[model samples]
Target: MVQHCAGLPLAIVVLGGILATKNNSLNEWRKISDNVKSYLKKSKNQRPDDVLASSIASSKQKERDGGEIAEDVAESYLMELVESSNIRSLLFFNEFFPEEALEKSLPLEVLNYVKEHEDEVCNPLVCIFMISRAGTSCLKARGIWRYMFNNFKLLRALNYEITRGDHSVGFKLPSDIGNLIHLRFLSLKDLKFSWIKLPSSLGNLRCLQTLDLRVGNYEIHVLNVIWRMEQLRHLYLPFMCKSRTKLMLGTLRKLLTLVNFNTKNYYLKDLINMTNLRELGINFPFNFENFNEKELGENPFIIRSKYLHSLSIITQWLILSIDPRHLAHLLSSCTSICKLSINYARISKLPEYHYFSSHLAYIRLLGCEFKEDPIRTLEKLPNLRILEFESSFEGKEMFCSAQGFPKLESLILGAYYNLEEWKMDEGAMPSL
Candidate 1:
């Protein structure tokens, strides 16, 4: 049955199992054999086993040193189709080539086949091209980018990372990148380019959802173009040409994740406009000495983010001390917040009259000082399940006693330099 199935190893194995069944009979066997034979004859003017062997042979040829046998056979088949006679490229052969061997080596014959059959290639499959080098010299190789971009149009993703080596040379992206309108994800990391001006045609990629560009030294003007992509969901901007620029929240309302906003002297008001933002990480300037408790209370950035669920601020103590009123307002706005992390440089007294988040399930405080009455403030958080305090100083007699946490389940305290004892209620101790 395997032989009759034109060497289709999978079909042969499956049929062998069926033949071993008790219900299998001579008539059933005959029917299966006849169907396999018919399928082979219809596929080509050869036995099914012979056709499968030919396919294997062609695949092997393409895999081994980009041999010409596969290309010749594939080209012949295409020419005979007459209907697709104009199609010259043998990309199909390239697709069938073994992937493992192709990574460390490129077959010249395969390249030649693709070039010669370029006109014949009618339908191209989605392909990913990745280039990464440790040093800069390798990135300067000529014609590499052009050759790849010109030949590959159905690219779904492109990731290129290169570092500097000898001379300060910059790399350039292929000019025809716009042709790959189907691109969904693009990542250019550590590229040596000094100034990258995105092609306006980038907006044509209506399907693009992610664009990541990271360079050590570059004037990135492509952000304006990226902002036009309505489908964009994730954006990472470690550095940009313009400093002290305010991002329009309306333009990035669709963004769900943003990172590396490491800018100097920027206002939080710029982010307040992003109504749909779910996760945000930014470094705001800190001036502990000049901080005004009243001015911090008026900060509009904290008042506008009504839909925020997870927040990580530079310092919880600074914000709380600078403006406890603003902190209270910010906490009140985020009723849906589930996770909160605050890093304070120094310990500050907690507000006397404060409301805890009803939805908060996880909280982490680092490098902060907690008073002896730490549990008193935490008692307001009815839903807190996990709490972590790292490298923090808490007053003595700070124990998980009955009056402290009634519903807290997980507690982790590290480097509690001043912690002496933990208090827990007689019967309200959490089931840890």
Candidate 2:
């Protein structure tokens, strides 16, 4: 029967459901097994792919435009047939598949299967850790969960893409997750809860290397535990406003990448301690202190991060307190930045005709209004290979200088609804 299921989890679930409805008599199960064996033997010559494709198409139609199917039909049918069924036997029979079957299936398939029938298989899904693979894992839960932390002990990575059911207003995860001693990578994405409170035991994941969470839209708080994940190499989260907890960042010496860093929660001194950082993404708050040329020169984090390669800044547009020239000076401090992306910034002018970062090779600007010809300054980047401008400038005419963008390979000028004249000088972009 396991072979007949062909290592497909969905097929196994359906077959298990069918058996769950039958009486727990040896003869009953034997008859069903015999019938399945006989059918497989007789149909050995049939194309399984063709049959499976047909079955998938039929299932899709009944599922209605790829949306959730009604579970009432499945539940009512199971209840009618197994009103007196033994739950223990059902649990026992569910593990008929070989251990290798669980390991071979992709994590995405397991997540989908569990989410599809969460109403029916939620308990079994966690009780049998067969759903999670050893190295990398993903699970999506809609309601309160208790056993997942206990079962996912050996995982090296876990991405919890959790959602809230209609009745669920707040979400909380078990502190036992700290027991996953081998965990290294963790992420939480697309969470929809009024407030998410992380357990203090989160500080116990000493081996955690990567922490990624999309916590901007929700009121996610109490994340001081992050300071304990000392080995974190990559951190992806939006600015957390109104936090008094200070990070013991010197312990996180291995940190190399940060995404959407909030200046409000941290200070330049804190960033200076992470001197090994490479790639960074920051949302420059409107109230951020302006840095003078002397201060920018003294900030070792920005001036001495020789490994810094990619930088993304999403500027706050509601207030324009800092002069645009000072912004250029701050970027120039990152002498090694190669790729830069700026969004929603209100820089009205470029400082001079010289490129800000000597090693900058790629640039992407979005929703920034430039008061003058940006090309005059951008065309001077010696190592620039790709330039993309999206709804960034209001100028209708742009002129490129002779022998400009010496090494540029690609240029994408998109969403410039007002651009009318683009004039290139003789020998302009000669290497293009």
> Highest lDDT among the candidates is held by which one?
2
Overall local distance difference test of candidate 1: 0.55
- Candidate 1 on 217-240: residue-level lDDT in tens? 545555345556666666666454
TM-score for each candidate, following the candidate numbering: 0.54, 0.62
Alpha carbon lDDT of residue 227, candidate 1? 53
Which segments of model 1 are wrong by more than 4 Å? 1-100, 103-137, 140-143, 149-153, 160-181, 189-207, 213-226, 239-244, 262-267, 286-307, 314-327, 343-356, 369-374, 394-401, 421-429
Q: Which ten residues in a row have the lowest lDDT in candidate 2?
A: 130-139
Q: Candidate 2: where are CA atoms >4 Å away?
A: 1-145, 151-154, 162-170, 239-250, 286-303, 315-322, 353-355
lDDT score for residue 201 of model 1: 68
What is each predicted model's overall lDDT from 0 to 1? 0.55, 0.64
